[model samples]
Target: MDFHKLKKELITYSKEIGIDKIGFTTANPFDELKSRLIRQQELGYQSGFEDPDIEKRVTPSLLLEEPHSIISIALAYPSKMNERVESKKGMRRGIFSRASWGLDYHHILRDRLKKLEEFILTRVPDVRLKSMVDTGELSDRAVAERAGIGWSGKNCAIITPEFGSYVYLGEMITSIPLEPDSPIEDQCGSCTKCLEACPTGALVQGGQINAQRCISFLTQTKGLIPDEFREKIGNRVYGCDSCQTACPHNKGKNFHFHGEMEPDPEVAKPLLKPILTLSNREFKNKFGDVSGSWRGKKPIQRNAIIALAHFKDETAVPELIDVLVKEASPVSRGTAAWALGKIGGEPAFAALVKAKVVETDSEVRGEIEKALNYYK
Candidate 1:
């Protein structure tokens, strides 16, 4: 009946339950986003991780019957780790991006959505609702932008004034006719920081990204990283945040509002050499809870090898040699071959020469050859 009063109640309950921000918007089809998605698809810019169906992604009505309005919620995560892990002379560490610093945000955001759903059910007993996080067909950023959660920043992140771009976003589509909130004004006028700071130039101009070239997206792929981007990836074992970290809007905006989001320094910034040797069980036990580990340990290990190369970590040369000779995944072995070359010594060079004789995989052999050249 009184939808306005109900919206007020939902906002109050959301804050009480740790939702950092909440907003409402009509369930009209996202025409603009659909066009952009088409363009991204045409240009081969998509990361291959998004929903393939353009209609399903932009049309909320298809997701839920007669969806009248959408509710968007944001949970702020800490940008800075309160505790620090020391990287000594002989030991180097790789950093997981801020989003993956703590617990997997999917679990945290889902918990908040579940609470909101229960609260809504109490007031509107027959309310029809659908909720989703990053993996959902509906675009979380589009919903958040329409719902006034934040402006779409140049980095392609929803930038909330209070929390900057360091916030996890999710949404619920409902049959309730809640009043829609106005979208925020674009604040990234003439700011090329994100575009300039992108290592692979993934940020195309402004307000758009070529996900294929994005270091964040590349780190998540379960294959050999392109040779051009490998050196640019540096020590990022998970996602890359150069774009967000470069945004002026995110300055001094760290918020440790939720306990689940606190980083375990050792897990978030672990020693590079240890990651090279993690068993599947060991990787799961240590990084299983973080969002970045969703692709399993192969990509992380691959990135760890690259990070060792980035640092030219001589200490990791032995472990990298083992991976080059014995790792099951070709991506891992190939990456290790590259790392060994980057950290060249008599032993590393000898191992590459040895592996060159027996390595059958064309890709692995190619990487070994490349490493040998680099070593010379």
Candidate 2:
């Protein structure tokens, strides 16, 4: 089998199918990644979503029988929207990061990977292959970095010269041996822009990130967002893009190759108060297709409340009061109490005072008391 010829054919096919970048690497175990994950666990830096088995995560052979090579693919999404969302009077909108702007990237990358698998099967009828998007056990970044798709940027993203770090990544492990591509040289070069731009210092140092403090991870958590990061979260409704936007390589790197990847302006930057009013069915109808909605309605709604607090939107006080008094979810109620306190006034203060007396949940009551102190 002419593996080199197959690789070239695959590359051409990838482009034809809308893959922005593609690279090849051996299915060798990722030793460095295993150690990094162990250290991350030790330091309590993990976001709790990582697949816990380190061996399975780094070992491709375990995932696929006789895996000989891995192919990494990237698809660029637009960094800037073609049309901007105009915030109307008395309406404060929360921003979803560029990564979560359009359809959920997992689906997009998976579709590309599936097509690649089918193409390979047409050439080698019985060749074994395993494909994975972000949620797969294998680290998409590690595979992409080694495959020469891009360098692992300080922001912990794969930064391609062509598409910058604003690309979704996926990989396929195959039994067919293929020639490897040269790894990209690190070009970050003492640049600390991403580190400096991290709102919660989630980027502990360059490539290392404390996911617990990361606004992206925090926004996806079902529990109450920690006090330290809530104010830092600003108006983000889902995910965080500070590090990516701050990276020098990403400047002038917007790409809108795929229509499915284009974001609806209103959905990407939806009004804060409206978010608080979404029922489970309504939330799913509005946001289910987006990757940020994987964790479902609670986390996004909680983040919306925080965003309202960040804006100090007095207009949100009534809705927030409804959340504080009528909401069943303690996290939402507590966060609403805090938001009301943040947007302080007679109504807000009165609401908090009322909530403080009647709030059943200890956590919610504590939030109310703390919010009342803000009035002092």
Which lDDT values do the candidates have, in the order given?
0.94, 0.92
lDDT of 2 by residue, 1-376 (tens): 8988999999999999999999999999999999999999999999989898899999999999999999999999999988887765569999999999899999999899899999999999999999999889999999999999999999899999999999999999999999999999999999999999999999999889999889999889999888999999999999999999999999999888999999998889998889998999999999988888899899999999999899888888999999998999999999999998899999999988877887788988889999999989
Task: Please report, as a residue range, the 10-residue window in candidate 2 with the lowest summed lDDT.
Answer: 81-90
Angstrom error of the Cα, residue 21, model 2: value is: 0.8
Tell me each candidate's RMSD, in Å, in order.
0.8, 0.9
Q: lDDT tens digits, residues 1-376, model 1?
A: 9999999999999999999999999999999999999999999999999989999999998999999999999999999989988876569999999999889999999999999999999999999999999999999999999999999998899999999999999999999999999999999889889999999988887888999999999999999999999999998999999999999999999999999999999999999899888889999999999999999989999999999899988888889989988889999999999888888899999999999999999999999999999855
Candidates in order, TM-scores: namely: 0.99, 0.99
In model 2, the runs with Cα more than 4 Å from the true position are none
Error of 2 at 208 (Å): 0.7
**What lDDT score is found at residue 110 in candidate 1?**
98
